[model samples]
Target: MLINDLIILQRGADLTKIAEFKLNSFNSFFINFIALLIFSLGFALILSITGIEPWLAYIETTIYNGQILGLFATLLGVVILHELLHGLAYIIFGAKLKFGIKYLNIYTMDISGTFYTTFEMVVILLFPIFVLTGLLLISGILFPGLIYWMIIAILYNISGSFGDIFMLIIILFMGKNCKIKDEEYGFSIYT
Candidate 1:
């Protein structure tokens, strides 16, 4: 059994198991769905309240003209970009990076035993959301033709990020100076 480096700690090691970030598939799905709903409602409200006619027109045109294939492609690209940002952050923080996909989940991780500081892990978690949102916004402005794709990417990116946001909340409560290892299921925090 080749467990990643952090797995060794759980298998039996010197470090105390401070916390286990157990993943719940149903919870993740539920939260992501709820987030999407809330965001959509809020965005609609803002557009209506603020009288953002341009945005309204763009969205109307997009909904009417967009194809299923384009939507899927844009969303898939956002997911790929999201994982790449995690990989980039991992490398920037001195971890050996590896990428993998299983079923619908695409991921980038440090395969070796190298664990990261809480701050480093936070950056790894959030880098994608911030960077991608910024890029999508800039692209939407610079190339109006991409507005349809950008809107889809933005919606997906924000909704997809709730998992990372949940982990961020967890990391905030973790013990100070703790080491974090990305695990298959979630995270293993060692103090």
Candidate 2:
């Protein structure tokens, strides 16, 4: 659906383009941060509850032992590069430029103004995976110790890529006429 359509949504359009973009940015960042925290906390809780052997779970244990400064730097680097890929993909497809954000939920290109076919959509969706994978593989092979950072980068990209993955699936199966409508987290794809 288009941005104007979104304004006519059932609850009534409550946001201007700038407001919506700002809200989206805040939501994206907050959600990703909360998800990561919850994921880590739940994993830790499970391990503690199960009485896992600490030394045997050395990888898990060591992750938490990582240097805070290094972690933040790695995360910031991954996020910036990831968004840059998105922006570049938009340009390659000739889509109008839109805002980019560091946080997961808030980041989006406001290219509803332009139309793209399924193939172009696929290109946009898959660009980051292709770019980041090349970067990850090269870095991991050259400096094996950087595997952790690679993992962080890949997962970070994938977290946001879920929407693209869904888009690709629908466009492939349902054709260009397919539209994804929300019903909570999972979407309903129909003509």
Candidate 3:
């Protein structure tokens, strides 16, 4: 099948394969979760100990009573925009989107079964970094009270984007042989 016609086998067509896929993905998700948690907590602690509050944090806690709500809203907006960029980029580059595949054990998920080019994935991966930065800048100026939440949201995006960046690095290193594996034995084979 062409990359454009790809589909993720949610159940893997058999119990053994299904169990294997789940186990592999579960392990990956667990490691990612722990890494993200530790990194984020450590970074936040450093900020606290150094008395280096981001400008947004000061404004958020000081002025508005609804600051918490604003932060939550901004965070939700950031995540939605990030995923949308990926899906849209896939579509624009001639790929179709299957259901998003969230690893039940992790805070992140895959945009499952997307039919896009390597170049398409790269662009999609970078899109949110730029887009989110622009949004943060504009929102910071327009709504200072949401700054703390915005910082958290940006950090979250960057942490997740780390893997995408690494994926791109491997693709570049491996040349055209780069493909996201769906399984060890039954990957969505790419040419």
Top TM-score: which candidate number?
Answer: 1
Higher-lDDT candidate of 2 and 3: 2
Question: How well does candidate 3 match the true structure, expressed as C-alpha RMSD?
Answer: 6.9
Top lDDT hit: 1
| TM-scores for candidates 1 onward, in order | 0.78, 0.56, 0.60
Worst 10 residues of 1 by lDDT: 3-12
Instruction: Spell out the clash pairs found in candidate 2.
Output: 24-106, 25-106, 28-105, 28-106
Deviation (Å) of 90 in candidate 2: 1.2
The Cα error of candidate 2 at residue 172, in Å, is 4.0
Q: Summarize candidate 2's per-residue lDDT along 111-140 as a digit string, tens digits.
A: 434444556667776898788868877887
- Count of backbone collisions within predicted model 3: 0
Better of 1 and 2 by lDDT: 1
Cα lDDT tens digits, model 1, 10-33, are: 644756768877556675566667
